[model samples]
Target chain A: MKSLAELQAIKDKMKDKVVLREGTGEIRVVVGMATCGIAAGARPVLNAFVEGVNKENLSDKVTVSQTGCIGICQYEPVVEVFEAGKEKVTYVKMNAEKAAQVIESHLKNGNVIEKYTIGANQ
Target chain B: MKELSLNILDIAGNSVKAGATKVGITITETDETLSLVFRDNGCGMTKEQVENVTDPFFTTRTTRNVGLGIPFLKLAAEQTGGSFSIESATKEENPGNHGTTTTAFFYKNNIDFTPLGDVISTVTTLIMGSPGIDWVFTHTYGEKETRIDTSEIRAVLGDDVPLDSYEVIEWIKSSLEEEYDSFYK
Candidate 1:
């Protein structure tokens, strides 16, 4: 079993680093996680974003989280991106691969992969 | 669902949606049976709601016309020659003691039994998705066991530090993997 003491050590070491980035992210990536979303394979999409953001070293600027049903059962596995002073962008019928693309294009380069957006699906 | 862990994630999400401050999940495996129990300290359902929960068409959410989380889980267990049940006490009925407990038993020997895949990801996802909720998880395979309590972790890290921090989430994933590793060794 892993000890709580080791967890304590991690906290002590990362405490300062965590404080610097706390609640100050400029972009938010929210994945739909309701029943509809889960059945449509949103878990991997969510994981892809989290891992993608971490791997790209964008953790300080981007925060990936989850939301409940967005009322679009036909378009399950939805993802919404919220950035300061911009219209919220909704992506529909997403997968892990698309998530990585979204991170690379929209989150990284400020190019909102409009092809994957809900507007294109509609 | 393709995997049982996904069902666990879906069902536990219900607990979170119910405003549960603390959720307890236990997976006990034996030679023939795999049992799952999810208990929460949240607003429970009424008798009528509990009765309708397993119906695919019934849902608490106004956003969608159907709810499949509970129904699918029930089907998953029953398909394996197992059983599923839910008990709840609404806040109006039980006052401060309101909550829900869902249990399912699966006969692992049955051909229809689904594999429990990537539970570490399911758990870490839940923790990251809802850091304010204290999640207590325990999985026992015969004599070996793996356990984690977010409340304990929170006590160590204190309120200023969030459980969903990248480093914290990574630590949790590795810790769980280490525990599972010891089980095999």
Candidate 2:
């Protein structure tokens, strides 16, 4: 079990290092976390994004946060990626495996994973 | 919703939105039964309110409700050869102090148990992921049982955020599945 003191420490350490909402050159990865989203496994998907970014050393360039309902309950566990200078890509029905790919190709290499994107499904 | 877990999340969200400080969720499984009970210390509803909660048309929030959450929970429980119930009590000291508790139970042989694992995961994940909310979850598989305390995790993570990050989510998922699978098998 992790503790709150540790999180505060991390937050304290992060205060000067990372600006949360600057939206400058940072890559934003947003996970839908509403009731519908969580039910569809958003928690794991969120985790995968955090881990993938941290592991690949893209923590500074990428920021992950959660949002409320997307109103598309059927296609939940949704993740949206907004790069510094690209169109926003929304991925639906995401799991951990798919999230990893998003981190690698889309977040890091600037290539979207077509099959996982909303446009591909349509 | 398509998945039962979604329904649980929706209902639990209601409890939080209602100003609930503590929520209790229990999942019980036996050779003959499986059940889910969600109890919240939020505002209790009147008889009329309770009756209309499942109507899918009476929403307190301007966000457009149709009361799908509770009704969905009721339907899920019934489809599995179980039943649903809601009870509330008005606070005597505090005029507006009240709470509502909903319980949905399913008998094992009544509905397909294929989704049982998913349901458990959904509820556990939702409870664990939310912060400032105290939840006690109990899972019983025949004679084997376990309980998770969100406060313990909260103690570790502190007040900055209530949920564990992605790494913690994976750890929790595997840990829960490992515990439940032992009884499931």
Candidate 3:
């Protein structure tokens, strides 16, 4: 079992990392979390984004947040990525694995993972 | 839900959606039963609303018109030979007050009862996720017990220190884990 001591360590390590990224980021990562989204297992996908962004040290460039339904309940857990001045990319039926790949390929490398996008399914 | 903490989050999210300023959550474990209760000073439901909540098709959220948190909780408890219930004090009916209370009992000794998940995660996430809302959480394991009230944290935090601040979130997690340790460890 994990302990309080571990949480303390995380704070000490993340202080400068999270605070510095407060407003300078232009890339937005949004996870849908309405009842439909949550029941479809969006929690892990959301956690993956929060942890993955911090792990990749992209907090300085990306902002992670949650939102209610995007009106497409059947395709949840949906993740949308919005870059400044660019069209939003909606990724449907997401899981932890795909979230990780998005962070690595799209967030860090600047190349969108096409198959994960809504267009791929359409 | 995979974990009790997630269930807590889901239910509390409903509290938040209902416009609750203060939410109370209690968890107890004994030789006979393991139970959880969530009470919130939010918008209380009508009798019709409460009765229909068990019908998987009912939902208040306009997002997609589906609700499952309460129904699943009722099912989870009943499946284990335990019981589940919901009570509400509607302001319209009561005149002076309003809120919703949900309770679930799971016989600890039952073969189908699920294990209590990481509760530290439960309380911390509740606080971290909703900085504006106040939370009171009580946990009991056997004869030992622990209570955490965010108002106390708020008094120390003052106005400038946000509950969602990096350090505060860390401290809340540490303190909650320590408290849980006192009961179970």
DockQ of each candidate relative to the true complex:
0.71, 0.25, 0.24
Superior candidate under lDDT, 2 versus 3: 3
Clashes of each: 0, 9, 0
Off by over 4 Å in 3: A1-21, A55-57
lDDT of 2 at A115: 92
Scored against the native two-chain complex, candidate 1 gets a DockQ of 0.71
**lDDT tens readout by residue for model 3, B1-185:** 66666677778888888888999999888878878999998888999998898887788876555778888778778878999999987778875678899999988777777676766665765676677888988888887888778877765555545566546665776676766666766
True contacts kept of 1: 0.65
Fnat for every candidate: 0.65, 0.22, 0.12
- Candidate 2 per-residue C-alpha lDDT over B128-168 given as tens digits, one digit per residue, 9 for 90 to 100: 44656887767778778766667766665554433444444
**Best prediction by lDDT:** 1
Check candidate 2 and list the clashing pairs.
A2-B156, A3-B156, A3-B157, A4-B156, A4-B157, A4-B158, A47-B166, B44-B99, B56-B66
What local distance difference test score does each model get? 0.92, 0.70, 0.78
TM-score of 1: 0.96
Q: Which stretch of 10 consecutive residues in model 1 chain B shows the poorest summed lDDT?
A: B159-168
TM-score of 2: 0.71
Flag the better candidate by lDDT, 1 or 3.
1
Candidate 3 residue-wise lDDT at B108 = 71
Per-residue accuracy of model 3 over A5-64 as CA lDDT, tens digit each: 554455556555554547578899988876667778887787788778877878778877
